[model samples]
Target: MTASESMATDRPDDLPLPPGPNSYPVVGNTLGFLRDPFAFYDSLDDYGDVVSYSVAGEEFCTLLHPDYVEQVLVTEESKFGKSDFVQDAGERFVGNGLFASEGEFWRRQRTLIQPAFYRERIESYTEPMVEFAADAANSWIDGETVRIDEVMKRLTLRILSKALFDLDIRNQQSAIRDAVNAINEKGDAGSVDAFLPDWVPTATNRQFRRATDQFDDVIGTLIEKRRGDPPGDDFLSILLHATDERGEGMSDKTLRDEMATFLFAGHETTALALTYCWYLLATNPGVRGKLNDELDSVLDGDTPTMADLRDLKYTDKVVTEALRLYPPAYVVFRQTKEDVNVGGYRIPAGTSLTFPQFLIHTDDRWYDDPDEFRPERWTPEFENSLPDYAYFPFGGGPRHCIGMRFANAEIRIVLATIARRIEFDRVAGGDLDLRMGTTLEPTDPIEMTVVKR
Candidate 1:
């Protein structure tokens, strides 16, 4: 039966929603949501695993349990799709790219683009990721404080541009970064004005539009130029020639969306992961020592290769643990396509359901001390003992982030390359605010002093 037909109900009122806070009329829980959406969702654990809440007038249920998450994102995925709110907000910047698209369109795009991120192709990016990270490390002066976030962002952007598109966006980096920041702020759940209509033409909205247009102009030109040139090895070249089973390649507009998607997804989250990784390392000296030990033993003072990275087990654990605490994409939202009972709550069709990685990763049931940065916790025994959905930093199911493998490799390469060459410590007394934006970014500049080792 079809999704709607299966969900057809006789007494819709009989379905009971999970318990939650009493919301005010009209505004609902807008105030609480505006105060802090991530915290608001966290508070729902006090009510129940599946609890109802509202933002503006719309009803949303937050799912905290891993079992519930499994059902929503994996087992019964066909009965759910990307949240309308996410699409509405994400499209402002990413357009109908993989991050925003749904249904058959998303599937087709995934098919065409999946090859660009394959293990073999992603392995090729290791050299550039290492080179860029090394360049950033070399540029830093000993004993001089620098904003680590800015450093990572620049390194990641340079790597992404060269490795993915084979284009140098150094000149356009500031404008592109600003555009991404604007979209992130506007799209954030904590932004009270996030629900504002698109036609309103607010200042933030105008900036968002301008940024996207600027990105489009740049990407459009790249596409037009690449269309006539001989195919190269970068993702753009692969995309230029990529054809489906029907033997048709992506159109110019589709190519633009995918390029924008890569620009945002490729650079943004990895930058945050590297930033947080450095923060974790600086704060935990013992962990840093262990990471360095593994690097030294494995590399013997040389740069890491793709094959050598496998033996850098402790380094991988560091990346995994940091992602657990500060997942770049902290939450995944889905809209139910049909009536479904999950965790004993009957969720109606068209309801928004959230699976928050931040909450799941921190749950004490699966973790010994969830807040602690312990790379050793990621061993095979622990991984085997835990639930799959309990630690999904890269999301889960078929719709999980396609670049996860690529990202894993990139983060490891960058970390190993920089760590072997320099010693950096987080400056004392700088505010470490974990900003909730399109991706989880630092609210305050993460200042650190770098010294050549």
Candidate 2:
């Protein structure tokens, strides 16, 4: 008999799944999962690397080890697909865009849009990133308290607009921002929506529908306007003209869906990342001092350009380390396509897979003094020594985030520009706690005072 068959036969059918928390009849672990999903996942670390649980009759398994994560994300990606719950929730906001689409459609869209983020294309946006960041910094009252989270959100939105669309929608910024926030706020907090039907037209549902329409109208108008205008180097222009191997261009709806996906996905994660970065810098003066020293030597207090990015090594390490601790997208969801064995555990088809980046990133096995903020630990030698899946702030495998390079460039440039021109001090007391939503963000306002240099 084959070893695979032998192992499978030896494992009892009713041996009970990997150890997990006991659940109330029928509802399963729904209450525990909803109370605090991140904390619940963290608690599973003590259970074992592979822990199983069921919610409302649905089965799930959380993979903690990097090797197991790699099996699901990279080596065995074909055996799985994006979770249906996540895809359904995402489609409510992003439509059938790349964020929600699967199979051949996703592959084709990814191919057509890939060129917009090429090295040359991304490098072209550096000047605007620095300019917008400087404009934001200059607008702040030096001695007064500024809501750094809002500041980063507005700055990133502007940068994504200028960098990707090459147009200004400042007049519509507030409305668009509100619409996005409403959709995110109403999403089944922490856990995916299983109990509530979106069609019920509750106040939040009506608001979500109205907000989605407003966002769609704005994006649709921009698409029409670009059709008649002279060809430009913006991302919109690239998407408009792109042709697949069969020379077929995307339809208007497809264009709108992808644009919305980029606008939504592009800004929020980066904004939260920058927000957390500032919080870290404020609390850790030594790391901030080293960062400022690098900036001073690199640019001599001038605006940074694409050429300066290579010289900003420590700046890169700081951003990398921040992402390690507080990845904006804390959890990734996938569902099995067929029965599979992950690390000797048999999982049936349609089982939900949760890969917690927040947990894997802080595993003491990979990082020494994991809780401590140490940028210097991310040296070339140390980074090379780690496994690929061990540090995936942007995710792994073929379906990883397409704009990783673009986001990194924007974060480094913006962080350097601001850090060079201003210093920040922590104003809020007590340990800063995280609030889970569409992305992981601080529960309380991260109030900080900016000291202009």
Best TM-score goes to which candidate? 1
lDDT of 1: 0.83
The regions of model 1 sitting more than 4 angstroms off are 1-14
The stretch of ten residues in a row with the least summed lDDT in candidate 2 is 1-10
Per-model TM-score versus the true fold: 0.95, 0.94
Against the true structure, candidate 2 reaches a TM-score of 0.94
lDDT of each: 0.83, 0.83
lDDT of 1 by residue, 378-425 (tens): 889999999778988888898998999888999999999999878788
